[model samples]
Target: MKYDLIATSAMGLESIVAKEVRELGYECEVENSRITFKGDELAIARSNMWLRTADRVKIKAGEFKAYTFDELFEKTKAIPWEQFLPENAEFPVSGKSQKSKLFSVSDCQAIVKKAIVERLRSHYKKTSWFEENGPLFKVEVSLVKDVATLTIDTSGSGLHKRGYRVDQGEAPLKETLAAALVMLTNWTPERPFSDPFCGSGTIAIEAALIGQNIAPGFNREFVSESWDWIPSSVWDQARAEAEDLAKYDQPLDIVGSDIDHRMVKISEENAFEAGLGDLVSFKQMRVQDFNPKKDYGVIVSNPPYGERLGDRKAVEQMYKEMGKVLVPFDTWSVYIMTSNENFEKLYGKPATKKRKLFNGFIRTDYYQYWGKRPPRDNR
Candidate 1:
């Protein structure tokens, strides 16, 4: 059935997420921090498999302005819980309230949970004791200026857990960030791409997948696969679609390098695990040693931003070395994701494009540099 679905994304990644939704042939209405769309079960499955920038996909159950506890109890109970939840399923609710008639979040959570449980008890005649063994029930309650909105999370775990990167070094980029960096570039399998500071090989692997058009969820299983309502045939169909998109014989020139030999080894292992060893290459080399190939491509990296690796001075030197190595590739476009405010000074130029982003709790920025100016005619 068509339902209101909201895909939550990182602060600055909302536009990218909206683009992904639109590419999937869905009409999305963009909001402040999320995108709202209406789709069926297949849409849910597709989002879980393909959305690289979204944090969670939530299904709207119901919404209303509850000026009092009594109104909240009645409105929440009216939501059709049985259609999505089994008679024997156990569910819970959690909420957050601000500037609303109901200001206490804890109280709101307890009330919503009680209302849902009561509705299920009467519908199923489940007067006896019951245990909650079904898939996790994530409830979101947002009260802004006295209006309350509730949604159920279809994805138990965030989509970033692609299950391939079991091993990671210090300050590794999130899988979502890696995927975003790939999407932000113009790299294709016909050309070459490189990451000089490829920690754990996230960017290289993401690029390989992008080149092959393989679904990001190919290496992992999502929590939605366990829901009783979604049939196995649907999942099989999605898997088939993903497999059909995979081009095992596709040509690609992707390389990852790191000064630390151990990180290089980790990257190799990850590529081997993801079955991308043939498409991507990993090496233990410093930034100065990397020589550009003939075909034009992209260089995207999440370099260490003076955190844990060394002091501020050493980090600046490292970025300088990175710039020294990257500046020689006249045909390549370089993108750096960092939390350092002085990265522009280190890199020696104001970015052609700068976007504000967040890496977990750290406020970050994505800096893009064009190695060569475009022709006057093109401009």
Candidate 2:
């Protein structure tokens, strides 16, 4: 049962997702916001359980070029939908069109739905209307320059929902994005890691997960788990392997702090729910007061952007304070994500390297200041 799978990611994270796919022993092609790969049923289960930075896993059912409604219908109908969707399946078609002949997204969705229904009806042979009492198969039709790609969503909920963090602070970072921020750094399990502005402790928790080699999806479920096309034994095997591969006994040096006491409490609760109760520490403190005792540490933070006009002056002052406090630790690498255009100027030091990233539609820059690695004898 070889299938084409697509792991969708944030706009700037396609390469990271591709790296994850390749690490899973699958060949992948990296696109703008997705990675297309070849795999079997086990690959599907494994990917859903292990990819920490992907938004969702989908099955690429078919792809073709279609200019007119008739062409769209024919091309969509040509796909073997019966092979995936059972007679009682609840399939809902969604669509998007961009710079294509079929500019109307609703019309495209309706046409695709009709084509799939007709195909299923012909294959099943006794269908007036499908009961749809079974598992859900969400189908999506995307058109770009008149090329249509049909896919079925395998993850009902986005992978960012790791079943933890029932509560969060204002403007909480997505778990997927948090994992990506950790991956962007050069931090490892041996190095101390801290997040000064840890809103709900997403970055610190993600760092702990990385250090322990824990699968982000270990505590979650995916839509494809109930699909008839995939065997339950495959999922069982994948989960068992994930459990065996996890390094629960591995040591980690991670901490998170926030100015708000309530947020600190929320971070503790989330960390406990993530099964990292004793592995990571959380405290309530201002960023300027942060003083790590270790050298060659890594500090990654997503701080206030000062988007409101009234808060601009205060946030600028905070940034200046951060510069003053952080400059003394010349041996610690600092990574900060912020939407402030003048962050470098306010921080009083230019970043060694800067990368453009999006923090939930607010364009931000990741300022990286590489610290010199400690000598081998000290390490």
Computed on alpha carbons, the lDDT of every model, listed in order, comes to: 0.82, 0.94
lDDT of 2 at 168: 98
Report the poorest 10 consecutive residues by lDDT, candidate 2: 370-379
lDDT of 1 by residue, 188-225 (tens): 67767889899899989889888888788777777667
After superposition, candidate 1 runs with Cα above 4 Å error: 307-310, 372-379
Per-prediction TM-score to the true structure, in the order listed: 0.93, 0.98
lDDT of 2: 0.94
Q: How many clashing residue pairs appear in each of the predictions shown?
A: 0, 0
Top candidate (lDDT) = 2
Per-residue lDDT for 367 in model 1? 94
